[model samples]
Target: MKGKALFLFWTLLIGFIFSTNGTLVYALESPNTDNYQKDSSYFFIQYNGEEKEVIVNGNITLKLTGWADDSKTTVNGNITSVDSSNSTEDITLKVNEELNELPLNETEIINYRIIVADIFKSEIVTTQELTDSSTIVVQNNNGTSIEEVKTVDEYDTVIENKGLIYYSSGQSGEKLVITKEKYDSLNIVKDTTTIESNAVSEVKATPTTKSIKEVQPLTRFSKSSTPATTTTVANKVPSITYSTHIQKIGWQEAVRDGALSGTEGEAKRLEAIKISLENTPYSGGLTYTTHVQKYGWMSNVPAGSISGTTGEGKRVEAIQIKLTGEMATHYDVYYRVHAQTFGWLGWAKNGESSGTSGLAKRLEAIEIVLVKKGEQAPGSSERRYITPTSVVYTTHVQTYGWLQPVKDGAMSGTSGQAKRLEAIKINLENLPYSGGITYSTHVQSYGWINEVSNGQVSGTSGQAKRLEAIKINLTGDIAKYYDVYYRVHSQTFGWLGWAKNGMKAGTEGLGKRLEAIEIKLVLKGQSVSVSATQAFKEPLKVFLDPGHGGNDPGAVAGGYQEANINLAVANKAKALLVAQGYKVYMSRSDDTYVSLLDRSQKANDLKADLFISIHVNSTGSGTTSANGIESYFYEYNPDYPSKINEDMHNNSDRIKKSVTLTNLIQDNMIQYTGANDRGTDGSAFSVIREAAMPATLIELGFINNTNERQKLVTSSYQQKLAKAISDGVVEYFRIY
Candidate 1:
């Protein structure tokens, strides 16, 4: 055939063979006329000079003749049935009387190397009328000759070697061989074409070229061939390659198959990932998603595309990977991650979630492999998916009122503003177990208040009271799984150290106020850097003097020794001050002689921050009507009562500070005891005048008054006075 004519013929034939809409149509001759049909269930094979249709579960017979070494041989095979239920869904031909199942589209040697069938979904044949003049004779290697008739238009590229003829179908590089019957069915007027001798031998000697698609030899046998050579299918093993966008390092070099794609034991994180298949035998690509830090699970992306974030510093926490289309049928994609805190987790396969979710963990390293269908997995698949709990809290601040809630170790109150935290509410979110968080607080005017649980207010709100200290604890099953950690910013002290599991987080005895707070929930067994004990502010030093102790009882009325009353009140006040985180020193802890000069000298030598000398007032014997509280500070008057030294003149700042301290103490005493206010005064008294720090002298009441004396000697009245004094000291420090 002429090259141009053959090319034109093939162009028209190829166009007619494949449909534009994807459905295949075959033009079959019914021994008389050419007709077309859309049949995918049947295929036709030429045997001798007859066209036979092979159907599923049907029977057929063929006498396959081939030549080797210049000799001719024939083999009879009866195909009893065809089964399509195998793993690959290829048709299995039950050939010969042995009922040997031979898969189609594969090379097999049945006494001779022959391709049983290269079945297409559709078949077609083009014919032309021919005369005896068009016939040609081809000679074989054995000097044997056969008359080949010009049947149909000659194929554009036909290789006739030995007895077999090879031709291209011109559709997707498919190869086909023309039998004598398939040509005879074209209604040629001349002699029929026939196979030459040594057909199989010539095919075996000829090496496959790029013009033809290579056919894999069949590995299965008919129980007759040499235990069947295993024909390894090319590119059968999937090539899975992946890259990770790591922390610090960007996208790393891609790794293939089951190689590690991230880090191991380095504590680095995988922030993003790109997975792809190279030279894979499947039709579709891979799809994957990642559980990312802050963002959670991201949407799935196709193969070779990024699944998480990059340049955001967020970690890929968990992952889900899957194969699509024919790839999913033949292989399973299995992956595992070395997570932050968790190390290497169990293998997850085919879209199952791997690594930890909800927990703020990073995927440190990852390994991925493609396993053939029904194969053993790489490792155990026992892992946890954690939904971390959140601790939410709110605080009520002085003047500003209750603030909005915050969660997960966030600060909930103001700082550096001198505003006090007055109340608090706390709760747990997404807790994976039963029970809750409970807390209590110490407030002004009230000691440790009642405990509150799970969002209930812990301290006084709306009342101008300050929260001094707090204790937080977890309860029930929640406590079993986690620990609660908390800390506070307090007045005078700044930020205190962390306290956990019901330990106090703020100041105790010191009248300091809580300014801000932070709370956190940690998983059990996880390490948290906590202080050995709650931090505290350096305590202020206070010097207390019980006036006229031992034999020096300055006032006595109603069987009450003034020295005994002063000692009792001073002791109670010291206890209260010490509890508030104050360092208190008394001139006399018990009944002992302490002169005014000795008291002032002791306070100065100790370098006390504040000095207060306790005394009882009297207007000589019958002053029963005079009763009240008065406080005195020192003011050096050179011309009035006594000579003022240079050191006394240099104490102007001390004198002003002393006046403020005296007024605070006197006002609190009057409020607590309901004593008449005798007001504050300045006097050149030795106790106040000679002290280095701020100093004050408090006259509790007229000791000669019968009613006041009765109250001063009692333990309850002394405690009231002590509380008032301690409160006044707290107010003084808060202002300073």
Candidate 2:
């Protein structure tokens, strides 16, 4: 017993000496942050091209700054001033500095004038550079590849054919007569306003003012208005009005009410429709066809102005409604006047006719009539409403499925909004109930039910930020979704499948349950069995080492060997709690040469709840017998209070000196084969000392005793030995 105690004492002493080597650093394990916190320093240039800088020293701060020129379009570059004081170092910018804001999404390179002296803990001066000039590239979108001239002088002068003093062939009153071809070519087809397209038309005109009779051939657009002056009047203009129709063809079955659906006119008719997502006359129901067009008055009129007219009674341009579906007998879509920002608008117009324009909203408002397929209808609506973001399907051999919080609004931290499921249509070829349908609901962005284990939940893994611990469960039955769920892939551990209560899904009268979290799937006849009685040192991980290796051939005497002795001791210690229920992750079950670090790493990697490494002492004695037990633990996180370390060290020694553990085993060995009792003592092992959690390494007994060596080799001795180690763990937890 005395000898065994000495071994542990030395082991622990050596462990402490090596801990200050700096290899014991570890991160505090915690769940991910609840929200994103910006924490980076920045610099920027102002509109005047000056530099500034600021640093984010605390939690998070959103640095807000922008180029100063409101009228100039150079608003896209970083706004910072240059620093020239330091000759050997370049100055870095801070986001808080008024003149040092980083351009929005700009890739500003930070150039360091001097090389970093310490990569891990060093700071260097840096300069930031970004794109400039126009800041935002201005493109000519006039369609003709013509040089875009912005200044008034660039494209203003026109060389007369004979220097005839004026360019236009003729002018009527104040009207500039241009070739009819030019008017239609510009395709200036618009309701006006929204795009801010050339409010001031730049057409050439005579420099001097003259009476209508004197200015015979010169022509130009109306000039800036003054209080006393009025816009020139036109003698003749097209007089047009609505034909009392919203749609102009065979496309009426799908039109909705109140939605605008036709083009602008002096009296041109625009089209529209409105529908609800609940009920729909889809394909094979009442399908139809129609022509499509976009009629916009948004620039000139308000989004809320109900009718195709304005407040002052001016007839504003009407928008159009378009379509794409099956050819059918008839179609019915609803329509309602535009929804104004201020409130509601004009009367909702409903149209029912053969000739309809393909541009109408949905058909459910009862505001419009259905147009028969193949019938030509004129005058009304245009626009597509249903928008799509992502699409996914499942395969027979799938990866992931239904997540949790089956109930619609139950989850807390969300990765992102899951794409809403439209319908999973399964068209089977030769299967039971060939026409079955299943509705599926997804709750995670990557389609994964990601679970974060304590050890891995910390920043040790590759997550940009620590990920939360909660999981998202997909609700609803997914089976019978299609002939085959062909594209599903588990975004998490992979192959984690979907659940349907082990039955195919049917959509005869489908509605997802609101109480369900995701369904947990189990293997056929296999289930996850958890015991509440088991103690959980959650967030605490531990790795156990069953010592003595593949061919070490430990202490030998009278047909007895220490290698076998070591394995027996290790096995006994493990069984004790696996029974009491400690989550015990083992390093080696059978004899193996797990490197010291490899064994230590498993424990480290697990950041185990605690660690326990076992082994038996050996000695060369012709007539030998010696036995006892001892334990060890280490503590050293500089940031941690020294008191914590002192407490842990004291606790470890108490266990080593405890008589119950060492005595029970010693008695058994002595009874079986008389041997000397080496008293318990403590010494920290490298594994124990470097461990982030509490740890222990035990030396069971010396194999030098003639009778004891013989007994230690026996299976009976090993089991009794195992019981003692197991008892020790129970005692430790009970007391601690």
Candidate 3:
């Protein structure tokens, strides 16, 4: 008994040393090994664009720099005499001398360490397997990439066109220069409003006296109002004036408001265009589209905006625009484009534009659109209410089929009720909107239910089932101009992933219970004022602790190490959680020792929503009979401060949460691993008791059990266990 106690003490002492120092101190007996022989390996030194190949027998010295960009420290020398800025440094490469004598199927690596200087004092160690002509990049000891950082400046746009002329305001009826040549012909005006005793002040024109008729025939756009005198009231008509910069013509005459200005039949391209609007008060507002050289049609832009590329070198071919929404019915939109030789052909209304199809003619200059309020639709013979611009929807919920329909942007499903949705429908009232609705739902027990289109039923009406999630998108013509963004409020992981366009947005696997949803639609660059009220909730942020690592290998038996198994399973679980978009973190990603306090502290610091410590069970020698999987959790105490929830008092919420998690994991362990059921139990384990959030410690089964130990180490069994744990976590979130 005394000898056994002494042996245990020594084992613990070795473990402590291994933990403090960066090394492994094994207490187990060494396995038998065969003699090995020296082996030759090849490698290439690579830096920037330079490369050198060589064979290494035992050790080789490399000339290196502090950083790849610092060429001042370059020097070559053998191991001990490295030409570093600091004192002499040493590098050593170690390999099994008799590797050739080992079995051919065995794998081995050569280990090397370098005492680096220059940036700081440090040692770098790494292992490399013997390979033929492998490229080795010499880098800093701190593992930072030695490449120089590149900085990019923000982009700025500059405009410089000789076609744009500047003018000044003078007296009413005074002639205004409209062309560059005409402006240059005058005593070039330097300052229009500035005046001083000795300064040569230039006269400017005001609205009443300004006569903008000095422009030549090519630059003069309007034939309507010609050099209006103060005597005659100026005729001001609502209009849109535009000018296009052609490939060769530079800038042609600016088109009169509401008139076509550019050539149409020529095979030239319109390089750039500028538009200006006046006197229209349509609520829908004005926007235009442009077809560029390579990129087809670009999105619409507001009036007085620039379209088509200038210095970018692209040309505008075809174009379209519209007065959207209320303005769509109020005004008729018109536009026309310039072509190579055909000057100002016929005008196109609405979204139409006149331009050559396959002809390579450039659109030199272009005139802008003119919006004219159309006469009210001839009074209908029979009285009818105005049509709505959007569609409304409603869902027939479980136990309550066929609810009243709601308006656009309103909630069609129930929230905080836990009630399931059975069927749903939408209405456009047969009013043409150039599109139809297509939607899919995730229902209880059924992953993603069949998709429904228009006003068709998405889920079964008679079935007493719950609706988990839903996705909605537009189809047909209107879809080309609109986008939808939808989100769901679920029982677990509330307010799950947001789905845009036609992508699935809510939880699918593990059957999360969806409580409410909010759907919205908007035109590009515009805000949707839709609002749907529902109970809001936060998402789960879980932290996984892979217990025991590095020197502190837990419960080793049957040639299996507990720490290794724990890390493997925890990593797998984390991956599964991440794939589902759950925020997750692991206590240890490598074989490194971590204190129990530190593990719990990490969860507290991260304010993790859930904390789970993964470990393996083991009995003393000759006690392998203790098998099966179990989960342990700390009893909730109000006196303890909750890091995840500040409002959490001595309430039973933590206890309930922990127990749910424990039972879920334990049940899944048994179901997936087919191990004996040990059930969930309460405990004050350090990892659980100190955790501020709902926490659980799971013992995945005894490594000492002969049969279970064999199954525990297998990759397939680990993956199954991982999947089960992930499923349990999802279930816990779903319910709580």
Clash totals for all candidate models: 6, 135, 30
Supply the TM-score for candidate 1: 0.41
Compose the digit string of candidate 1's lDDT tens values, residues 1-736: 2433433443454333333223332221111111211111112221221123322221212222221221111123333333363222222232111111233323211111221221222122232221111111232221222332211111111121122332223356443445555544433315533432211110011122212222222111111223222343353566898888776455577798789989888777787887778666546667898997657677777765567864344578889999987779889999988887667777889999888776667888889999989889887877634468899999999888999999988898998899999999999988656899999998888988999999999998778999998989999988887899988998877888988898887776668899999999988776577773545444679999888878887788776788888888999999999887889999998888987778878887887899888888888887579889998988776654432224652377877788888888888999999999999998878777767788888998888988888788779988988888899899988877
> 1 or 2: which has the higher lDDT?
1
Worst 10 residues of 1 by lDDT: 197-206
Q: Per-model C-alpha lDDT, please? A: 0.66, 0.32, 0.55
- Superior by lDDT: candidate 2 or candidate 3: 3
Question: For model 2, how does the per-residue alpha-carbon lDDT over 1-736 read when each residue is reduced to its tens digit?
Answer: 4433433353344332111212221111111112101121111222222221222111111121333343222322222222342112222233111112222112222211111010111122111211111000111122211111111111111111111011122234332333324433554533212323222111122223211122111111222243211222122111111112232221123333333333333222222221222122332222112222223232221111122211011112222322223312234333333221111122222222222122222121123333444544333333212111111222111112223212111221122232222212122122211122223322222221333221121111122111111221222222222112111212221212332332221111112111111223222233233322121112122356776577766556666655566766666656665766556677777766666557766776775655666666665556643455444444334453332234343354534433234444444444543344554444445555454455666665666665555566777777766666566555555554
Clash list (residue pairs), candidate 1: 163-196, 509-579, 509-580, 509-581, 510-580, 510-581
lDDT of 2: 0.32
Q: Which stretches of candidate 2 lie over 4 Å from their true place?
A: 1-384, 387-545, 549-551, 556-560, 580-613, 619-698, 704-736
What lDDT tens digits, residue by residue, belong to model 3 across residues 1-736? 4433543454454342221123222231111111111121111111221222111111222323323222212223222222342333332221111111111112222222121111221121111211111011111121211111111001101111112233433466333334434443453435433322111111111224322223121111222334434343234345666766554344445575656555555544576565544543433455677776555677666554446754343557667766665456756666555454344445566676545443333455555555546643222212111122365677877666777777646676677677656666654443323677789887777767778887888776676776766778888755664567667667645665456667665555545655555565555444433333222222458899999998999888977799999999999999998887678988889999999878878888888989999998898674477788889988555555445334432246776788889888888888987888988888757778777778889988889998888888988888988888899898997786
Ranking by TM-score: 1, 3, 2
lDDT of 3 at 655: 68
lDDT of 2 at 408: 16
Question: Per-residue error at 122 for model 1, in Å?
Answer: 70
